[model samples]
Target chain A: MKLKGVQQTNWIGVGIFVLIVLIFPFVVTQSFLLNHATFTGIYVIVSLGLGLLMGYAGQISLGQAAFYGVGAYATAIMTTTYGLSPWIGLIFSIAIAALLAYIMGYTMARLSGYYLAMATLAFGIIVHSVLVEWRSVTLGASGFYGIPSINIFGYTITQGIPYYYFVWAFAIIGIIICLNIVHSRVGRALRSIHDSEIASSAMGVETGKYKTQIFVLSAIFAGVAGWLFAHMSYSISPSSFTLDASIIFLAMVVLGGSSSVWGAVLGTVLITMIQVTVHTLGEQFTFITSEFEHVVYGLILVLVIIFMPRGLFPTISSWLNNKMSQRSSETQEKKAS
Target chain B: MLEVKNVTKTFGGVVANKDVSFSFEEGQIVGLIGPNGAGKSTMFNMISAIFPPSEGEIIFRKQRIDKMPTNAMAPLGISRTFQNLQVFKNMTVVENVMVGRHIRTKTGTLRAALKLPGTKKEEVSAYDKAMEYIQFVGLQDLYDHLAGNLALGKLRLLELARALATEPKLLLLDEIAAGLNHKETKEMSNLIEKIRNNGTTVFVVEHDMDLVMSICDKIIVLDQGEKIAEGTPREIQSNQRVITAYLGAEVEKNAQ
Candidate 1:
């Protein structure tokens, strides 16, 4: 069998993960952690796309939260102002996000490294400013409210268990789709672009086109997550989609391992857990402040950059691979003796 | 068949390639030889459409391709290897070759992400074809190895396999034998002959005279951005201008 780009999926691990997700709500029965898990699921959808764009395609974007906000506002306005269904709002959210991403990425894809990062950063700030300044359309600083919950066949997805299941389903589907792309010929070409754009183009992989396409796709993912976030909370402010949020999305991918889909998901979960822990600790102790979260994140990013530059998942996986391979070789030698 | 018509490439004030021209027929191993800064690589870059020449036209299979985009060359049946090796270091050997099959495969990002049956079928064929090229270049054992782990000679062969995976009608090899030992160079020469026999036109730039003279059906000599001589190896060796350009006037006088 041709085992070039088609790596074997770890089905057993996936199965165990599915079981945990299915049983988690029943086992915990805590609304706080369940809500946090649901939010983690939504963020995973965004991080997966960012991982493909930054980690594999080698394009940096600091405007993902803008796409997320665009998705949220698209659904928020359509459902609230126009009296449309949440589903219709979701479609519009994804479409608008994708369109804006395409327009931005067409010109932005040509820039690399710090230039691209700064451009995207500026874009995020601009979007946030529009959300705040456009008082009539976006409701300004008061925030957009009255967004309806998703209704599926007479069942409403409320903030706790139902929302958790719904969000996790989308996250799982997102994982499959991202994994599919990463394991195919398209994945190879994207990675080729990451390594060397000139070489990629020479190999007949249109580097500019691929970069723009991935950027748009990532925006769409963020938009979908935004729609979910807007519906789940039923209110969103411009503050949520700030430059800091985009940086957090990037950090999630970078922390987990940008190259792998699961790494992005893991990174999102870990970051979310950290945030929740910090919040809980801050409430329980006077010494621990809200600002402590940023300090921890900064420290983690610095340590990750210094030590495990490839990110957490890849480093851990490679170590596991070495151990497994060594054990197999040892067993083979013993059998031969 | 490929044709270079009066190509002149000027970088700022310096003339890299001045009004130089040559053409070769299909299914032949052609060698381009020159001293340092003889504009051999510049000529190859022009043919491969890396950049447009200041004045010239490169016709490939009767199509004028001098002003085309670099990516356009692969679809027009042209592939090349860089002297410094530009293989994707993070990818596996077979995966790197699979990337070369990009022009041949039509599965886009959406279809691939969806895992469509058609894309899967195309991917399998590409993988099989990539493996065949890897085997052709004798890298079957290292097919799964990351390209970054390969040695210099192996990296060059991997690059060749990748170019071959493109299934180009014309292959441009830039300094393919520059760092190879005698045995490896001999193997590369044989491989070039084999590639020609298999109906792919081979264009090589080399400083290794023995490998070039033995394998090349025709040799073109360049000196100071101009074509000094073009003929069979024996004819090029006998040409006074070619000898003098390579060895200098004093060395030729001493030899005589």
Candidate 2:
């Protein structure tokens, strides 16, 4: 009974997700929905990493898409050119991304706020340019094509349903790992550093080391997601993993609330759904164009930043709890009268 | 025991401390009295390993600690409170103290992540220690309050509690009695004495002459980055150079 409340809520969330994932193929029966779900799962993985970095650690990283791209490009090159297994490439992607993250984090951890953001933004742009200009490796503007689908135990997951299960498996693992990290000692240190780096360091926390570790860990998560993305789509493009994509990932983290891992999943799912729906609507109504989606996104970001800076989950959860408490109070008052 | 040998620190061309050498025996409350810009805080910072001294050695229980980083120094049983009050504002009062105990925590990041049996036990112990420290600082009632929301006096107490939670062998208190009423200063002086009685050597940098004179077993005076005098409080009160440099001729004449 002590854990009954938490268990009930968790079960409710898990049940809804299970129903949706199971019934979605039957209801839609379209390749578009399957694609959207795959993309949504990828975003979920990346957003979870971003959430841990920005929300918990209080480090705004604009270079996560760069790491994501790094994973994709690394896997693409290894698999296509060297004929390496995608699984091996996935491990290497994490290593390379983690190494890059360590260097960047060490340099940028000392910088604060806008300066830190600018540093990461510059890094993202540099990576994007490298992807565009590196002809032999990334295939430049022609893009890397014919990435082999993920193969597990000699079974090629070439279809949407199989790929959906793969993406969901990794997404769930990523979420669980992030949640565990959030409640750990490192998590406490990250929160303290976010509040005041000086105070944290003075309290005998190796502030710089912890920040760098989190940065690298988050990058590894992003890299894993990128690996999944490349394998799922069976294609890679420089355009998809641009600075704009990085911004979209950040928006997902902020919109869903950076404070909780569940927020990351909710945010990714919500944003992906909106994007798919908007694209469909744009096809029907010529006036509702793809360009307008950015405007809508910008407006939503502004509203969230202004009204609910703690993010959607904390805000919504508190409101619901408050209403429940009020209703209970009213019932008690009536019984007493 | 704590010893600083020929500690010299310079910020670019400006010399902050020059050949500052002193020793504090265990169980003694030593007062470092200095005028503004007297390198009192600079010395404290160096001793606490916030920054390495330009040329010198810091020996704590005969172990050189000058090369150690601030974080590592805590586990070496050295702790300090900032002059500006470096309490973690976003954390609760108890959590602020828990940060001090972080070095002693046996739980690894992985164990903490998994919420394993070892980590859970450590967590319970840490909470208990934090509560004990809160009570030690007479902040039991406000243990749940955010440190930033507390009053200035309470914040000072919180900083003291946090530092104490490190279970330090040597405590460096920078301007602990700087902004307090007469009664509060007296209480703080008593608290410093209590801290000393608990087997922790204390080095306090304070401007309140009355509190310093009453609490300190020995007094070291600095003026413009140099040690002007070092002796008993009565001897320091009578020293002509200390009078001229700090209290002035008028105060010396009044004392006579």
Candidate 3:
């Protein structure tokens, strides 16, 4: 069956991916590239959750970066302003983001398609405004600073390589959790909802309940990424959590293939590399504008939508499968001869 | 075990079903046949809780379920296929059936994502159970095939298998024989008989008179959004009003 062959190839791909992840830090010793890789790991965690929502559940949210910001600001305020432990701040950050998602999703989950997109877009704008306008709590646009690094067992992971491994550890765990959800009953129900909400409800799937739950779960993932990012950068800023970041996260999920978690990781890495390339190119070519990144993102989004709507991973995998099957059949014909 | 108490459904200015009532005991293959726009599908939808009746109640095993949501009906042992074929097109045959086991299993989203011991164990059993229904509907060979790739006949059977996966006490089949060739229609009728013999109270809405006549233990006929007749197949065939409904008053009089 095609199932077994596809699964075997997937395991092999995972093996190769693991090897690359382990060797990436050592081979790329430059802090500039390593910095991008570290950020890619953090974004992978967030995009994995978005993949479940948009890819599997067929729901869209344009406000994920708001949750990310909420997590960073929550932890920043908790640890720096209130003198709470970083662990406590981490929990608060995750809880606060999840709570906000639950409250918004309670009413917003009923909307579908472009309406839902517009609703979440408004939500992103509101959250971004709060980050800028709420001067007393968010420190306005000057940004919050001096946040303590995460300490585990009295060891601080301050170095670039150490934190890179740390960030990837959480991203790996996030991937495992997302894959579990994708394969389990909940995952199937979400996909069924994606395919046909009427049929899904007829099959006894509580669509509204599942939609809200996945929204909360996605927010939880974004919160974790934000917490890691806050500690990694040691600073929180409103500019980092703008609508553009949300669009980038969306682009990553779309480019990686929305339905697959591994695709999200691949998308995150590809998009991060593209960003670094754009930045480097902009510096080298003074003619290139600072706004070139958005232009490139827009072009990629439009091209991917037109050419590979299912995303890169599924398209490439299916093409590979077709080639292998053709070769196998030719071999069988030769044997018959 | 199911009762439709004077169910009446209206859409704006049009009354689709007017004061229609019917009830059936468990383990009987009951058929609902009607001409087009005769409210057969509307009655089925109301019983499946797709929409609440305008001025009536639906009772399943003595509990009022008219006000309940559609998804809640499955847990209460009422599952239905659709007239337009509501198969999950993107899912595989087995995955589509497995989703029908949603009410049967109780693993929440968090526990599933965590992949706890209980979730894994429940998944295995759910898979086995879903396979049982898939094989019951003769789709075991194509279990891995995506539903979108299946033909119209196979899609109908896939919908049946999915409904069976819910393990319902009452199964509602909406035009299960539609768009099938002669041989495929015969097989569908046989499958319906087997489903009824297996102890599911089958409630089918069909336009295929031959399939209904051969398989249904009792038949209910609707015309102009009202119950025109209800009896055994033999009784329904000779009933004057039923004949008139299907063949017009002149044909009924001429037959007499």
Best by TM-score: 1
Separate DockQ for every predicted complex: 0.74, 0.30, 0.63
Name the fnat for model 3: 0.72
What's the ranking of the predictions by DockQ, best on top? 1, 3, 2
Q: Tens-digit lDDT track for model 1 on B1-256?
A: 9989999999999999999989999988999998999999999888888899999888999899987889999998999999988999989898899999999999888998887778768878888999999999999999999899999999999989999888999999999998999999999988989999999999999999999999999999999999999999999989999989988889977987
Question: How many clashes show up per model?
Answer: 0, 0, 0
Positional deviation of residue A310's Cα in model 3 after best superposition, in angstroms:
1.2
- Pitting candidate 1 against candidate 2, the one with the higher lDDT is 1
Best by DockQ: 1
TM-scores vs. true structure, each candidate: 0.97, 0.86, 0.96
Top lDDT model = 1
lDDT of 1: 0.90
Output DockQ, candidate 2: 0.30
TM-score of chain A of each: 0.96, 0.91, 0.95
Question: Which lDDT tens digits does candidate 1 get at residues A191-269?
Answer: 8887777778888888778888888899999999999999999889999999889989988988999977789988999
